[model samples]
Target: MLSTIATTIPRRALCVRTLPISQTRYASHGTPHYNEPSGYLFGEKPLPQGQKRKREDWELLWYYGMFGSMALAAVGLYYKPDTRYAMAFIPQLLTALIIFNPASKLGH
Candidate 1:
């Protein structure tokens, strides 16, 4: 019975083709809006050249991380009498560099 059902089903013909980069609008802007009728078949939307996406859900995290670490470092920098303040300052600065990236932002 299963074999008969399998044999009864028809197969589809799949034809795939590629368009040249110069021929496509995407060549000008790296982002492909899945808002297009057929774009959903592709993957995530890409970042535009020299532009960025945001930290849609991570705004609170970033604020807490950035200013909190900065506060620690800033306090160490000004109030502390010793150069050991550099220790806290360094990690916070690096954290800012890593987390506060181009695409990363405050608020959703």
Candidate 2:
């Protein structure tokens, strides 16, 4: 009975088959290939146009201006020996020192 049942199934009906895919002649021709080297010398990415420099030129100018004024005040006190000019030098000197300190965050 088992031998008769096995022989009853057809070989082609039990077999699995894959479907064929349709191909176009223009498909391989239109694909782009980029195997050439790009013209960059250093291999570095380009900087954005909107990016600006971190340092401010005006901050250095302000520091130097305060320093120069302080020196002038000290000289004036030496020449005139007046209490008013000497008092003026005090604030100028403090300002100059504060601006020149490395730990100060004025420029940053």
Candidate 3:
């Protein structure tokens, strides 16, 4: 019964049909070459290569103020009691010490 059922199914019916496509396709738009600009851009000339513009007085003052503020803030944070490592750990250690105090009369 299995052989008769298999023979009834056509081998050609199992094949898939594919559409025929051309070998080459091209778009109808866009240039094949690039257009290069010939002059300085936007009329603002840049400084010559390997040369840096001198810093203005205001720029120097700004740099000093910014770095000075950062240094002062760092020093302030360093001296702050709450920011100290030992200070942060003191509260937790004190709680534990109070609960386990050797001088307590509750137990030996």
Per-candidate total of colliding backbone pairs: 0, 0, 0
Q: For each candidate, give its TM-score against the true structure.
A: 0.25, 0.25, 0.34
**All candidates' lDDT scores?**
0.69, 0.71, 0.72
| After superposition, candidate 1 runs with Cα above 4 Å error | 1-26, 29-55, 82-108
**Which run of 10 residues does model 3 get worst, by summed lDDT?**
28-37
Angstrom error at residue 87, model 1: 23
Segments of candidate 2 deviating more than 4 angstroms: 1-54, 81-108
Colliding pairs, model 2: none
Model 2's alpha-carbon lDDT is 0.71
**Which digits, one per residue and each the tens of the lDDT, describe model 2 over residues 55-81?**
577988999899999999999978984
TM-score of candidate 1 versus the correct structure, residues matched by position:
0.25
User: Which has the greatest lDDT?
Assistant: 3
